[model samples]
Target: MAEINMRQAISDALWEEMERDEKVFIMGEEVGVWGGTYAVTKGFYDHFGAKRVKDTPIAEAAIVGAGIGAALVGLRPVAELMTINFAFVAMDHIVNEAPKLHTMFGGQMKVPLVIRTAGGGGRQLGATHSQTPDAIFAHFPGLKVVSPGTPADAKGLLKAAIRDDDPVLYIEHAAMYQVKGEVPTGDFTVPIGVSKVQREGSDVTIVSYCRGLQLSMLAAEQLAVEGISAEVVDLRSLRPLDMGPVIESFKKTNRAVVVEEGWPSYGVGAEVSTRLYEEAFDYADAPIKRVGQKEVPLPYNRELEQSALPQVADVIAAVKEVL
Candidate 1:
């Protein structure tokens, strides 16, 4: 096992995958020269050279379109959008074209493509760039959405997404690149669409993913001090969302608090809470509580931005409320 941050973990995953597979290549703005906007691919340009580590123009549509074309032609392309907000510029290609290609072509072609981008509102990037629209992408049937909380999952999931024949949108939390955790050595991949119980407890269940999972874990720590045992479930994959762990944890605890970085309405929290009610209505001890960002444009000021985003305190309070 090796201890590494999310940034290094992601970098290691990309480097190892490219080394192992000749067809795996990277294309994005500043990926080849600038070494990735987040520095996850910092040394890849020099190591992999221009042919494999490509630098594209600032057009997200072109990047995604070209990636789709490459994938259709039997190459695995990891396309990076500097930010998740830029993904909207290429929404039609992402949602309409890349996803529909396999089914539309009657399985004659495969899009082994991975769209990588970071999301969340902690960098003071303002409302436009700081939105968490993961749920929007997951709503579509064909695309697979994944957001990992720990460095281990980040590395494993990225490797898995690159190997999978389907197009996967792998979202990283902008603020979580520095967070460190232990990662396994050698070639291994975590299966996508599986939820893992991050912290096991008995009193209540805290459901979250990505940035929210970090907040939930911190909240669980605090809750423990108060003699409140809070079980935490990380929904690592959103689209092919595996609700098995969530349902099992909810059934055991009989109470839940769903936490997410996005707005509560029509957000991840809403989806999890609704599902819990649908599948485990009888197990509920109280109505499930949702803690999410304040429904407003994320402010440019750091203080306002932090206040608007869901916090550890919010998760703790929601857990207490649900209990």
Candidate 2:
């Protein structure tokens, strides 16, 4: 086992996948010489050469459109948007062309494309760059959405996304890029639509993913000091969400708290709460609690930004309330 940062793990997954499949290529703004905005693709250009690791113009729509075209022709293209916020500019290509192409064509064509982007707030990136739009992509019928919380999951899920036959939205939280964790040396993949229990407990279940997953784990640790054991479930894949683990955890804990960085309105937490109510309402000893960002735009000021997002203290408070 090797300890690596989340960004490095993702870079390794891309490099290995490109080597394994000639159809796999990476094209995006600053991906070639810049090595990606977060340096996740550092040294990729020199290692894979210019053709396989290309630098595209500043147009996000063009970048995604080109990737979709390449996928239609049997190429696996990994398109990187500097931030998930810019994905709005390429929504038509993603929602209309990329996700819908194969179904629209009656399975005559396949779009094996992976769109990787950095999302979420915590570094004072401001409202423009801090939006967590994973829920928007998860709403689409044909697209698969993945958000990995740890270095191991980041590497494994990226490999699976690259090898999938349909479009995959691989979201990386900006705050977790530098987080370090143990990652295996050999190739491996975590299946999509699976939930992972980061910590097991018998008191309460906390469901979260991405950076929120890390926050929930911290909150769980603190809760343990108070004799309240909190089970944390990381929903790695938002779209094809695996709620079985969550339900099982609820059965053991009899309580749940869903956490997310997005706004409460139409957020991922809301969906998780709905599923809990639908499947395990009778088994629940307490009402499902949801902790999410306040229903307001993220502010540029540091204090205000902190207030806009969910924190460990907030998750702890939610768990306490549920308990």
Candidate 3:
């Protein structure tokens, strides 16, 4: 196995998928000659040619609408919105058309489209470019929402999304693109809707996904030094969320803390807390605690942004309170 960054892993997946399936093509802003805004598709235009690797105008709704049309006609189109914030422009097409076409039409159509976008704050991209809006898509009934925390998961889940017969919202954290991890040489796919226990423990469980998974892992390491063994569960897919592992972990650990970077009110963490209460209330030794972004609009100042999001100290404190 060779280690690589999240960006490289995603590029590899796209390259391999284009080679494996002629129907798979990529179109987005700066995806061709510019090699993508974050360089995830570097050199793709040269390998696949301009027709397959297209650079679109700065119109998210049109990009997504074209993707939906292509997917409905039997092509697998991976449409990229430069950032998740811009995805708001395409919500109508994504929620109304891409996810509903097949089921609403009684299985007469298939939209095997993959919508890839960068999300999260940490680079001072300001409030407009830094919002994590996966919660909105996850709320919709027919869409598949995926957020990968590592290089391997980024590669595996993207490949899986490209192959699936439904619309998949593949979100990549902006900060995690440079993080490196070991990735297998051969092709592999991590099933959607499966939660992964990153660290095994017995005292408490920390559930999170995407960049929050990294934060929880760091918190787990710090907690271990203080003799608290915390299990970290990464809910890779928000929609079709896999709560079995979460329930099982709570049954063993008896204490749980959910970490999410999104705002607390009706956020993914809130849903996780609700699910825990619904299925694992009796197993919990203490009430489930949720650590998420402050219930306010993210500020532009760097310090304020940092304060609004969850940190290792916050996770440690939340875990302590839950225990």
For this target, which candidate reaches the highest lDDT against the unseen true structure?
1
lDDT tens digits by residue: candidate 2, 66-179:
999999898999999999999999999888789888988899999999999999987887778898878988999899999999999999999999999999999999888889
lDDT of 3 by residue, 1-323 (tens): 89999989999999999999999999999999998889998999998999999999999999999999999888999999999999988889988888899899899999999999989987777778878877888999899999999888999999999999999999999888889999999999989999999899999999999988999999999999999999999999998899999989999998999998887778888899899999878887888888988877788899998988889999999999998
Candidate 3 matches the true fold with a TM-score of 0.99
Could you tell me which 10 consecutive residues in candidate 2 have the lowest summed lDDT?
Answer: 121-130
Evaluated against the true structure, the overall lDDT of model 3 is: 0.92
lDDT of each: 0.94, 0.92, 0.92
**What is the C-alpha local distance difference test score of candidate 2?**
0.92
lDDT, residue 34, model 2: 86
How far out, in Å, is residue 288 in model 2?
1.0
TM-score, one value per model: 0.99, 0.98, 0.99
Error of 3 at 261 (Å): 1.0
Clashing pairs in 3: none
Residue pairs in collision within model 1: none
